[model samples]
Every structure is written in structure tokens, then in C-alpha cells.
Target: MLKNYVAYVRVSTTKQFIHGVSIAEQRRAITQYATLQQLNIIDWYEEIQSAARGRRPVFREMLKALKRHHYGLIMHKIDRGARNLRDWADIGDLIDEGIDVRFTFYFFGGVVWRGTDKKIERVFLWIGGSPP
Candidate 1:
């Protein structure tokens, strides 16, 4: 189901690049995961800069692409890929538009969440997953 995915991986600093914290690792890992699932990687993205200092304009551009209904997006490490609520909101936007996002580190909120699409009751269920 996630075969048609684009892999995104990033590291914030040159030190991370030289020290083996690189998108190459993300590609390899995503490739492996995709292979196991019998999926195909349609495209890939890598950023060698920080989400905090804004070294990933391209990454943001790519997120814009995700809104076009790309099947899935992959990130080797969640923190390396994003750093705040705005960025997370952007990610959620993609999901709301029917894009599946995968993070090697974070599990997302579990069920897909869309402020525009979800009913208030569904929102409540999502918020209170542990029901009585």
C-alpha cells in the first residue's frame, strides 16, 4: 500500500553529514523497507540542513508537492525532518489530503487526522482514544 512513496531524509549540519548522520542512510533504510513490502519508491528527497535554521527550502517545496496527492512520504528520522507545530501542521495537511506519511522515529498520531474532514465526534474519538 505504501510502495508508491517518496523518501525524505535530512540532517541539520555539516557535522552530521560527515559523522554519518545523512540522508543516504534514510534512503537505504526506506529502500529496504519498501523492498520488504514489495513497494516501489517513486521519488526521493534529501536535505543537509537544519529545520531550525532553514536549510531546507527544497524540503518545504517538496512538502508542497505532497499536497498534490503523492501516495506516501518517508522520513528516516522525524526530528531531522521537522521541528515544530507549524511544520507538523504542514505534514498533517498532506495526510488530510490523503497522503500517508511515514517517520522512522515517530508514530504519528495513529489514525489519520484532518481538521477539515473529520467530524466533531471523530475528532473526539481521536482525542480520547482510551474510551470507557
Candidate 2:
């Protein structure tokens, strides 16, 4: 059986709509990744607010939904998933509860698994380059 997954796409600001990777681009990449991984995306949560901000209603909604359904989360990148330590910690908590969190981008030349020392090690080594 295919694992049910939820896709999250975010852009920090309205300005990003013009300059940075648009929501469409993130969604496209996530969709392709989901297809390659054979993940069944049962829902999608898109947000336009910065992850660094104190409040992200859509993100909270996604978290609530995940808690209820136990679906995996697939994000375009770590930045898209979380830019603040608090939010990152929330993701970690979900992982501790057996929720799978996946990033489509590779960091430090390798796959980054949630709740692993390797993920911590590679994130610090990340030099902000284009995804491979």
C-alpha cells in the first residue's frame, strides 16, 4: 500500500512571488518527488507567510491534520518546512511520534533523515547552493 503523504509549499513574502521560487515551482518539484517515491499525496498545504514568523495558520492546520491522520509530510526543502527553531522543534516532535518528514532537496551530497545526527551535521554545512 502506498503511504499517504501531505505536501507543503511556502513562499516567505509577496515579493517572493516575483523573485524567489514561486509556490507553483515548489509544488511541481514536490509532485515530481512524490511520483518518484510513489507517495500518495492525500492533501496539500500551501502558505505565503514566512516560517520565521510567530504565527502560521496554515502550518498549524497542517500539523493538526497530521496529528489526526498520521500522514507523512513532504516539503520542497528544509527552509520551506521551517525557518525558525521553534517550528523545527515542532517537526522534530512530530517525528518523535513516528510521523515521517521528508525533504525533496539533498543537502551536503546526501539524503537527510529526520531525527538523525547526519541531518544536523549537514544542515550546518549547507552553503546555500541550488538543489542538485
Candidate 3:
């Protein structure tokens, strides 16, 4: 089981950055999920860069940091995550390396995927309550 987490939170607009509602919501959800799963959040990377730009220095730095550590990556959702195919491919590579990629929105006790040649490919279940 993965015990550590590094969070990546992003906002596309300056307005959202000023208001901070989206970022705060994501952080709250991530914190709740971590608490329920008994996981430690070791680091956080926040950026105000737009996804359309497709060049987030902080996000790239976060990926590099992941390589030197043994922790899962957590984001608010896939949409808040990789905004392009290249970024998605990077996430896939991390999964292939047996790292967990968790989304706060889909935190149904966490989604588990097999990284090896196993018949049981995936499993999903609720932790605190019924599916929302």
C-alpha cells in the first residue's frame, strides 16, 4: 500500500487564482481522502498556469521530484491533471513503474489497478459511505 502522497493543484485563470475557491476545494478533498486512507502528504505543488499553454514548469518539476521519491501522485481529477496526451503518457509511465495515481473526485476508498500480469485488473469500493 502506498503511504505517501504529493499533491498537484492547478488553476487556469487569474480570477480563480485570486478567489482560490477551486484550489481550496481540491486541497480539502485531498486532505480528507488522505486522512481516511491514513496516508501522509509530503509535498504540494500549486500552479496558476493555464492548461492551454501546455508548459507548466511547476508541474514538470513535480514529475521530476516524483522520480526521486516513492510516493503516489494525487490531483483533484484527471481534468485537473494532464491536459494533453504527452502529460497523460507521463502519468502512464509512472503507473507502469508501480506508482499510484489517485484522484480526489474518484476517491471511492481509492482505485486499485494491477501493474503486473495478473487476472484481477481493478477493484473499486466505497470507504466511508455509499457512492455519491
Candidate 4:
């Protein structure tokens, strides 16, 4: 059976909107990645607020849902998922709790939190062509 995942995408500034990193683009990429990985995306959480400013309602909602459902999380990129240290730490906490967090961007390779050592291992899985 395929693992259930929640997809989270965000765009903070107008610059990002103009640069083609719109929520739609992120969603599309995430959907494609999910399909390729054979993972089932049960829900989507999108935030237009800047993570740097803190207090994202949608993000908080997603976190709450994750805690309750124990579903995996897939984001377009690390920055989209978390631009601040606190938010990053939250994600780390989830990983520490055995929650799976994945990024759609191939450039990120893959991030895994090892046991008690707290070591992070990067497993690169390049699909095709050169790195973006």
C-alpha cells in the first residue's frame, strides 16, 4: 500500500509570485513528484504568508493535522516548507518523532534523521539530466 502524505506549498513575496514560484507551480510539481513516487497525497496545506515573519495559520493547522494523523509531509522545497530556524526545528522535531518529511525538489536529494546520534544523512536520487 502507498503511504499517505500531506503536501505543503508556500509563496511569501510578490517577487516569488512574479518569478513563477506561484502556489500553482509548487502544487503541480509536488503532485508530479507524488505520482512518481507512488505516494498518495490525502490533503494539501498552502500558505501565502512569509515564514520569516512567523505565525502561519495554515502551517500551524497542517502541523496539528500531522500530529493527529501521523501522515508524511511533502513540500516543494525546504524554503517553502520553512524559511526560519524555529519552523525548521519543528520539522526536525517531527522527524525525530518518526514522521517522514520529503521535498519534491530533486536538488535537495533526500534528508533522513538517523538514530540517537542525531546524524543527518543525505541520499541523492537523481532522476534524469543534470542537477537543476
Best by TM-score: 2
- Candidate 2 lDDT, 34-84, residue by residue in tens: 887899999999888877774889999999999999999988788887777
- Candidate 4 lDDT by residue in tens digits, 52-108: 877799998998899888999988877886777678667777776778888777423
Query: Would you list the C-alpha lDDT of every candidate in the order shown?
Result: 0.65, 0.79, 0.73, 0.76
Worst 10 residues of 4 by lDDT: 118-127
Q: Give, for candidate 2, the lowest lDDT window spanning 10 residues.
A: 123-132
20 Cα displacement, candidate 2 (Å): 1.5
User: At residue 47, what lDDT does model 2 achieve?
Assistant: 88
Write model 3 residue lDDT over 1-132, tens digit each, in one string: 558889989998878875864888888888888887787899989988887657999988988888778578888787676777677666767777777777767655455422222321221122233653
lDDT of 4 at 8: 92
Give the true-structure RMSD of model 3.
8.0
lDDT of 1 by residue, 1-132 (tens): 445877787777778776675656667677776675566678777777778754578788788777765767777665766586566557666766777666543323243322334442353355437642
In order of appearance, the predictions have TM-scores of 0.71, 0.81, 0.76, 0.78
- Count of backbone collisions within predicted model 1: 0
